[model samples]
Target chain A: MDQFTLNLLFVGASFALYIGIAVWARAGSTAEFYAAGRGVHPVTNGMATAADWMSAASFISMAGLIAFTGFDNSSFLMGWTGGYVLLALLLAPYLRKFGKFTVSEFIGDRFYSPTARLVAVICLLVASITYVIGQMQGVGIAFGRFLEVDAFWGLLIGACVVFAYAVFGGMKGVTYTQVAQYCVLITAYTIPAIFISLQLTGTPIPALGLFSEYTPGGEPSGVYLLTKLDQIVTDLGFASYTEAHRDNLNMVLFTLSLMIGTAGLPHVIMRFFTVPRVSDARWSAGWTLVFIALLYLTAPAVGAMARLNISEMMWPNGTEGAAVSVETIETDPRYNWMLTWQKTGLLDWEDKNGDGLIQYYNDGSEALAARAAENGWEGNELTNFNRDILVLANPEIANLPGWVIGLVAAGGLAAALSTAAGLLLAISSAVSHDLVKGAIAPGISEKGELLAARISMAAAIVVAVILGLNPPGFAAQTVALAFGLAAASIFPALMMGIFSKRVNNVGAVSGMMAGLLFTLIYIFLHKGWFFIPGTNSFADTVDGSLLGIQSTAIGAIGALLNFAVAFGVSSMTAETPQEIKDLVESVRTPRGAGAAAADH
Target chain B: MDQANQTPAVDKEGRTYWKANIRLIAWSLAIWALVSFGFGILLRPLLKGIEIGGTDLGFWFAQQGSILVFLALIFFYAWRMNKLDRFYGVDEE
Candidate 1:
């Protein structure tokens, strides 16, 4: 069969499986829709959480970010996975024990303020909607590349599929569907990694293969791969792979932001509620991380190995020796991946100075200019190579099979769709549970709540799909913003609710508002309020950073501000009602396991 | 609400039970902070050269390796905490 047909078959089979699960596990009651009736197996919930957590960013963009930036870009991998540690230890079990339907509900009730809940909902909606646009873009890109269509059309098609599956399924359908999605995406991700790792380092495990010796055609078995990579990168005027030039302070903050963001995200936290007990919540989080680690561990290796392969292909004769001829770039059958990627308009090059040879360099470096003048190069010509293309192109660069490439297309879509479905569920539940029942109509019927949840879900998908069509920013780039909002607003508040008994309603509300508001303003001052580039007051630079903390790191500061404000304000106020305090104690106790307290 | 049906409570020392819970949280949070924010971020500079796999110790902690430890920590917490809860007479039916 043709490659396109095979891709369709693979992707179609996965979609069929998802729809089948949706049908089989369709949620009937509000309990099932919101919390899966608190009966999910730890292993099953773990698989679902993996799918919810991976998203388009982890599956499609993370490896690509590492592939291009080398060691300096390790922030993406570290930031994404390390957050699970925070989730597993600090957040998951407590929240599961608290036994709420949504993150906002926890905030609202714990702090005793509807405004706090509403604000949490707003943050959740904004972060989720903004984040979903990235997944939509992933779905479109994967579909566009595999199906050979415009990404916007692919996005539209993806939106329709999500609307049909996600609007009705809620958590019950989604939990089961995500199990299937986890399998598809993980299979798609590992197959190509194993193939390339075996080819490069003779190890099936990509993480270990990354550290082992290079297999550069005739090189010895123990040849250090990174040393070889560093030598080649320096020779080509690129920064050394292992050396980090970015501010250590800023890198630390960025990683912290991603960590908090990962832990605080509503879609991810909601998964714990599906499991049976507080203990299961604990076990399930570990399982989720185990599954996520499968990809996070491999991403850095893929990036390093792909970078080595691409650079070698461009040079043909080693980087220190000779450059590839212009004729070779255009005419050589070996450089075909460049042409294939170019069709996506994500990779571009122009032959400058009337020379057919395209020279790629860091024109930003002052030292490289003198070196370039001797080489008769005016500027770097390999422009417009979008960083997100790195992972998708890795398979082609490694000269993998057509079926593997087809599987990657399907895998990327599964990752994007699974996350989008989870987010939609969260948004719908928050609207139905927190906003509608908690504030708008306190006496909402179960049937009414379910109807409203579906409507909100359908609407959320529409908004996400529309934004996906004309993504206001780079695909993976907006994830930092989502994480920032999460870190700034959600993580600190949840932690405080569990750990600190002193924080009251006015305190928690004000703190959350302050954290989210300040983080948003700082991000806006740098990334532009709605992410329109020129409208921002400050640039995304170390100089422009607040106290030299990068935008990614600023969320940590917001979180600190939240904690401080909540404590400062609460200490001035009277104690919380005795019942609420008792409720907090009860959640922690796990006493009389099945107590259905109206207050709790 | 069925008030009569809900009060089939266990008679236990609530003070010692909660204190035990507190002790567990304190210990777990300490290690939790250590592995993630500690080893992955703050303490990363201290262990710069000690290598694991192909990358330095810090990078391993930040990405692949720290998560493994976290998995171990959580499951251990689950097992031990459950035992502790049962001992303190807080476990459910």
Candidate 2:
């Protein structure tokens, strides 16, 4: 079968499985819809959380980012995984013990104020809405490439699929479907890595393969994989592959932002609420990391191998050999992936200086540009190599079986759809459960609330689609901004609520506003006001950033500002109510946690 | 709504349990910081002599080692905290 047909078959099969699970596990009541009746197994919830956590960014864009940037981007790996430690130890068990359906419920009840809940809902919506935009764009990209349709139509179809499952299944449907997604995505991710790893280093394990010697073409190069990669890239005038290229301070703050943000995200935090016990919440966090690590550990290996492969393909004999002829790139079946990706406008080449060869190098480097000038090359010819295409195109680049390529297409869609559904659920629940039911219409029936949830979900999808058409950044970077927003606002409030008895309603509410607004303004100033492009006063240059920290890494500072504001305001305000203080005490201990009041 | 659920003995025990939990968290987080930020990023040059595979140990720590340690730390904390929960009579039946 043709590659497109195989892609349709695998993608169709995966969607059928998701819809089947949604139908079988249709949520019966608000309890099931919101929290899956608090009966999910720790391991099962862990798998679902992994699916919920690893969005389009993790599955599609992360390895690609790692491939090109090398060691400077290790922050993405460590930051994302290390957050589970914070979640398990500091957040998950306490929140699960508090026994509420949504994250805002805990903030609302703990602070004993509807306004605090409303503030949290706003933060949740902002973070989730931003996050879902990346997922929608990911879905569009995956569908556009595989199905040969416009990205907008692909997004509409993806939104409809998500609406069908998320509206009907709610958290319950999303939970099980996420489990299936985790399986498909993990398999799809690792199989190709294993194939590439074996092909590159003769090692079956990608992580160990990263450390193994380079033995391509059955010739013992006697150089380690990373060592050879560094040599090759630097020789070609690129930065050393394994050296730190970013400022140390910025890397620290960026890692901290991603870590805290990961812990603070409402969709990830909400998953812990579904498990049966506080202990399970802790266990599930660990399990989620194990599943996430399965992809993460292999990602660097995949990246390095693919970079080597691309470098090798460009320089057929070696880096010193003649560049691959443009004629070959245009007509060679070995370079077929380039042609397919070129149609998506994400991959393109131009023979600058009218040279009949494609020279892919860092034209930005003066030294490389000089070398290109000496070689009669005008500039870099690999004009638009989108980082998001690395993993999806890896199997094709290595000439793997058609089925492997199809599997990757399905996996990318599963990753995007699973996360989009989870974020949509978080947004809908915040609107229905926290905003409407908790404040606006406390007397609303469960059925009415369910209807409201579905409507809000559909509305959230539409908003995400509109924003996705003009995504502010790459999938992972855009997702990282969501983490920053979450870190700056919601996470600190939730943590302080659990850990402190002194923080009052006024403190939490003002703190969230201060953090949310500060981070939003900072991001808008740099990324453009409301991310509309060309509206920013200052360019995203070193001078434009505060203390040389990019807007994406500013969340840790914003979170610190939040804590300072909360403590300062709380010291002057009245103490928490006695009942609320008791509630704080109740959440810390594990007994009677399983019997959390359904709150319906 | 359930003010009657509160007892002086439970409150006293809860305070102790919470203090112990805080101590545990403090220690665990300190290690978490040490591995990821300290070894992985800040103190990486200091550990240049220690090499794993082709890369230095610190680079591996940044990318892979720290994640494994995080998993271990969380599981260890969970197991220890569960034991502490049972000891304090705070574990769910």
Candidate 3:
């Protein structure tokens, strides 16, 4: 079969599996719809959570980010995983003990305020909707590449698939489907890494291969892969691969933001509610990390190895010799990946100065400028390579079998669709369970609530598809905003609610609003108000940031502000009721968490 | 309501169980911070000479070691907490 047909086969089989799971596990009631009837095993929930958490960004883009920047980007790895520590330790067990179908339900009852719940719903919606948009767009892109169709057709198909599973299966369906997705994505990710690791370092385990000696032609070169990478990259005017170069404070804060954001995201937090017991919630978080670690550990190796491959490909005669000729890149079978990627417009090259050689180097580096002058090279020729293409094109770049490429296409869609399904569940629960049942129509029947949940889920999928088709120009910035809102607002509020009975409703509401608005305005100042181009008052660079903390890192400071404001407001306001304090005390213990219940 | 279900003895045991839980959390969080934030970033310069496979110990911690440590810490926490629940008679049926 041709490459496209193989891709279609792989992707088609995965979709059939997901839809089958959805049909088999179709939710029949509110209990199953919202929290999978609170019966999922911890390990199963963990596997599903891994799929839910590892979105398009984690599966597709993160390795590229780490590969290009080296050790400075270690924040992505540490921050994303470390949050589970906070979750398992501080949040998950207690929330599970509370036994609610939705995160806002916990907030509403614990704080004893509908307004607090509404504010939380707003926060959850903002973070989840923005997050879902990114996933939808990711689905579209993956579909576009594999299906050889426009992104719009890809998006429409993805939406219909999501609607079929999510609207019918609810959390029950999504959980089982996500478990299948995790398997597909992890296999697709690790297989290529294993191949590339064996090729580069002769170590089958990519994690160990990263630290092992460089082996070309099946023999050790007596030089470590990182050391070799550092030498070649610096020769091409890049920073050392293993050295830290970013500002220490910003890195700390940015990592902290991601950690808190990970713990706070409603979709992830909601998964803990599906487990049978409080202790399972704790075990589930660990299981999630265990699964997530499989990918996180391999990602840096993929980044470094891809970097080495690209550098070697550009300087086929070695860095000290002439660049690869344009004619060779155009015709050589080994360089076929570049031509295929170039057709997508994400990878491009030009032989500047009319030279037959296409030089690839950091033109901005002063040290490299001298080398370029000596070599009679005009400028870097590989000018338009998008980082997102690195993972998708990796199998082809390594000249892996065509089936591997097909597997990766299915894996990418699985990552995007699984996350999108999880986010839609969070959104719909907030609308139907928390908002409609708790606030708007308290007399609504359980069956009516289930219908509302499905309707809202369908609505969320529609919105996601529309936004995916015409994403706001600031895809990266909106992601930052999502993390910022989660870190600054939802996480602190949840932590304080669980950890302290003294924080009253007024205090919680005010703190959330303060943190939400402060982080939002800070990001707006740097990125632009509402992400409109040319509307930013300050540049996004370090010099333009407040206290050298970029907008991405501002969430940590906003969280601190939340804690201070909540404490200050509570001290001056009314003390929490004894009953509410009793509620907090009960949530802390693991006894009597029979099943997740909705209390109106 | 939970308050109605809880007698004085259960409440007292629950408080003690919670206290023990908080202490464990504090300790785990400290190790978590020391590994990732301390060894991985701030104190990386101190461990430059302790080289492993290719790079210094700090880089290893930043990319691989800290993640492994996080895994150990989480599993340990879960195991210990489950034991605590059983000891305090707070575990579910």
Q: DockQ of each candidate's interface versus the true one? A: 0.42, 0.67, 0.67
lDDT of 1 by residue, B4-69 (tens): 222223235766766776687688767765765566666777887797554577666665666677
Which is the leading candidate under lDDT?
Answer: 2
Q: In what order do the candidates fall by TM-score, top score first?
A: 2, 3, 1
Q: For the second chain of model 1, what is the TM-score against the true structure's chain B?
A: 0.77
- Give the per-residue lDDT digits (tens) of candidate 3, residues A15-134: 888777766677344345555626777888898889888988788778888888899989889988999999999899999888776778888888899999999998898778878777
lDDT of 1: 0.75
TM-score of 2: 0.96
**Per-residue lDDT for A474-534 in model 1, tens only?**
5776777778888988898898887777888888888888899989888878866566657
Off by over 4 Å in 2: A26-34, A150-153, A168-174, A441-455, B1-12
Colliding pairs, model 1: A67-A303, A253-A553
Q: Compared with the real two-chain complex, what DockQ does model 3 have?
A: 0.67
Q: In model 1, how large is the Cα lDDT of residue B7? A: 25
Identify the superior model by DockQ, candidate 1 or candidate 2.
2
Candidate 3: residue pairs that collide: none
Residue-level lDDT of model 2, residues A210-279, one tens digit each, is 9999888767889898999998898788999899988888899889999999999987887787688888
